[model samples]
Target: MSVNVPKPITALEALERAQWIAFAPFVFQAARVLRDRGILLAIERSREGLTLEEVAATAELPIYGTRVVLEAGLGIGLVTEVDGRYRITKTGVYVQHDPMTRANFDFTRDVNYHGIAALDAAVASGKPEGLKVFGEWPTVYAGLSQLPESVRKSWFQFDHYYSDGAFGAALPLVFAGKPKRLLDIGGNTGKWAAACMKHDPDVEVTLMDLPGQLRNAEQNLREAGLLARARFHEADLLDERSAIPTGFDAIWMSQFLDCFSEAEIVSILRRCVAAAGPNCKIYILEAFWDRQRFEAASFCLQMTSLYFTAIANGTSQMYRSTTFLACVHAAGLEVEREHDDLGVSHTLLVCRPRPM
Candidate 1:
């Protein structure tokens, strides 16, 4: 007689099992340190390959520690060893120059590295002890201003991961027929605007951000050869009398809302609605925490929240779609389409002005 066999497990079940199996704190911390330092990128750049001696000389790590680190990286498949020389693996290329790399590094070095260490204190006081941990400014952005220029430049790379895939993925979908005018609020470095212009040559985009961020955005747009297609507007979203141009065919808010309190989000949403005309389409891209999907829980969210609280004086959390829907409703707009990409921490909400 044949024994009864159990049915095959689902993909979701397999993913859950893998997640738990790989959730060691030591492994997580080691990964963070390696990713932050551009170690993988350095290996990739060394076309001639590098040895422990070379790595130690470049990174200023002790010879013994360098060997240990390289070995650990090799075990993790981030590096490949050939004839005693180390090189970056194909899968590791993204971290070397990818936008996600910068974002991840920023979260670890600037935010989580310090914040998580004080989790017990935060829990006891019911208030984040971010400044105490960072020992500098109250906000991450402000604190970054104090770091060496080299360290500060890494954030530009991180901005790519947040905007490139998540925001860029939705543009074609939202602007299927090519809209005439596009407004990008909190548009840092004008990368989203550059992507929009790249996709639709006829589209003229405007980027609105803080004055300092506007300068960076202008430089980026100019470098991307998109200066002709975009204009920079300097204004804080929190300001009541801030001038926001109206009658645009499309309005884009990429990775902007989650930086503030609920009240601030409501105010910004109201302002966004007022800036759009009856026919204007709105696209909102963000990372939201999915309450229903435990597999969807974000390490980026947990880490960034801690970082923002400690360093940027901002708040980062996985917001809910219902919260956004409410904002749309309050603004007299209706959701046209909603797409949530689970693999990456991104959600896209398309909206149109509600009929009077």
Candidate 2:
């Protein structure tokens, strides 16, 4: 039987979606407040559902605040009202409890909420205007170590939530050749370096990143007792002349290239190729927008691309798989192996320098 493909949304559905977008800020905070203030939890625990009075009492909130927020939740579809009672919908349940959703929500709230206001200007000027909210940095990465504690917590949580799961599945693929030396580019906080040391006792790992970033990463590796196996090479890749040290058996870039524009990525790849010896394998792991299995995941990535525009770096975007592949070819590299759906939403591209 032929599968029934979904058609375009009807006019009414389109209008509804438009309205949701128009009031997204209000709706987002309503859901956040509902979840954070315990109102949603109170409603979920009630088998028969909750009246505004009961919700207020249970959550220790004033009835006036409870009623208005729950009323907004009805419009947001996070809660439904029947016979003057409120209960959490399936989406509401996920919003309140799903780990990934919770992380993304907190990230949106704590990191992007105020900064996003400068999006239009950031786009117009091709600069991270939102970054001014935190400090005078060209990109968020430069200011990461200096960001407020809460912002740092949420940012790292969101970053690791997506990448950490892929490490367990990626380790074996990276070590398949039994390489004694490995280089991990953009090895933030040295988590991947530590994991590499733990995975193979004989392997020595070199972590390359900015000097400020290496400070935290080096400390972590030292505390984990992986310092002997892990070394640090600090250099800013944005500098055209920045050199990547040569002679490693394998190189790894996990969610790293997405932090750069297409041009920058190509330049960085060329540097990697220049440093790669014969028989060296280069691994590029990223959540390519076009490679996602679900449209929702793709949508999430596209939305995140805007975050890069307004907050992280204005030039970078979450690239399509095809776009990234072209950069690899431009750098005189070929994909020797491709791994997708490893964990969460990542795709791993194992590459080798093209024969001269």
Candidate 3:
């Protein structure tokens, strides 16, 4: 006699699997605590490795508590265990030593980890707590300078990822034409200029930023063997005295202009128009909100909008492409090209000055 067997019920199985869902918050909170203490870094630096007791001592965690966290980290692939010793994994190395890794962790610890759950308050009130979190700081960029050297290095390191051909693969495309006389407005550290010069040796790139930021840009460009091709101009975006230099073939504004009102953006665009020759091309890259893209909603954008509003009194939501087109029209420019890449919140708007 053959026995009939019943098929496994998928819904019931899924419910059983969901039993651990409630523990997710505790797990995340615990991981954050371990990350802030440099526990992962300590493990990475310890050649010949350290025992659990030693790691606990170095991290100032109680031995039992340290063991529990390390065990969890090991299970999560952040650490490896052989016999009684623990070693850092490849992911661990990236987190501990990689500039981007360090920056991301520090950003999370300083900005996100403390009050991630308070996002509802921001949403409800339409206000950010970043200023409350980081007191007296006019902008996140300004506040970054006040971070500890280790944390600051991490921030800069992570910032490199944006233009380092990781985020949108846009830089490589932008540098392909070998255009001479490039203007990088609000260019932080001149990373894009350095990248441009790296690809095309003949291109001359000028980085314009605030005096303090310009000093850093100068140093960074010089270090990248691009000082000859790159020049630094110190100016504030808001001040008329800080006018952009004229007759550049191409202009770049990356992650800029979002920190201001629509009027301010129009003013800046007008200045860009004045500096641009008839044939000059302008590149404007920024994150924008789209109501149609449901999955595109990101916590980072939510946090940034609130933070910018709270601290800089700047708008954070995506200014629509239509609005940008209007600005281009007001500035006597036309949008020649536009691109929206997958997995990135930014929109690239390429424009050219109108014939007078």
Q: How many residue pairs clash in each candidate?
A: 9, 0, 1
Best by lDDT: 2
Model 2 agreement with the true structure over 90-191: per-residue lDDT tens digits: 999999899889888989998999999999998999898998999999899999999999999999999998999899999999999999999999999888
Q: Please report, as a residue range, the 10-residue window in candidate 2 with the lowest summed lDDT.
A: 1-10
Of the pair 1 and 2, which is ahead by TM-score?
Answer: 2
Stretches of candidate 3 exceeding 4 Å from the true structure: 1-28, 36-60, 63-103, 111-129, 132-137, 142-146, 166-168, 175-178, 289-299, 311-314, 317-331, 342-346, 354-356
Model 3, residue pairs in steric clash: 103-154
Candidate 1 Cα misplacement greater than 4 A, ranges = 1-106, 110-112, 115-147, 291-297
lDDT of 3 by residue, 203-307 (tens): 888888877677888888777767877787877777665678997888988877776667778788888988888667888876655411433233345544554
* lDDT tens readout by residue for model 1, 84-129: 8888886567555565554675545544564566656654554456
Q: What is the lDDT of residue 118 in candidate 1?
A: 66
Query: Of the pair 1 and 2, which is ahead by lDDT?
Result: 2
How many pairs in model 3 have backbone atoms within 3 A of each other, for residues 3 or more apart or on separate chains, i.e. clashes? 1
What is the model-wide C-alpha lDDT for candidate 1? 0.68
Model number with the top TM-score = 2
- Candidate 1 lDDT for residue 135: 55
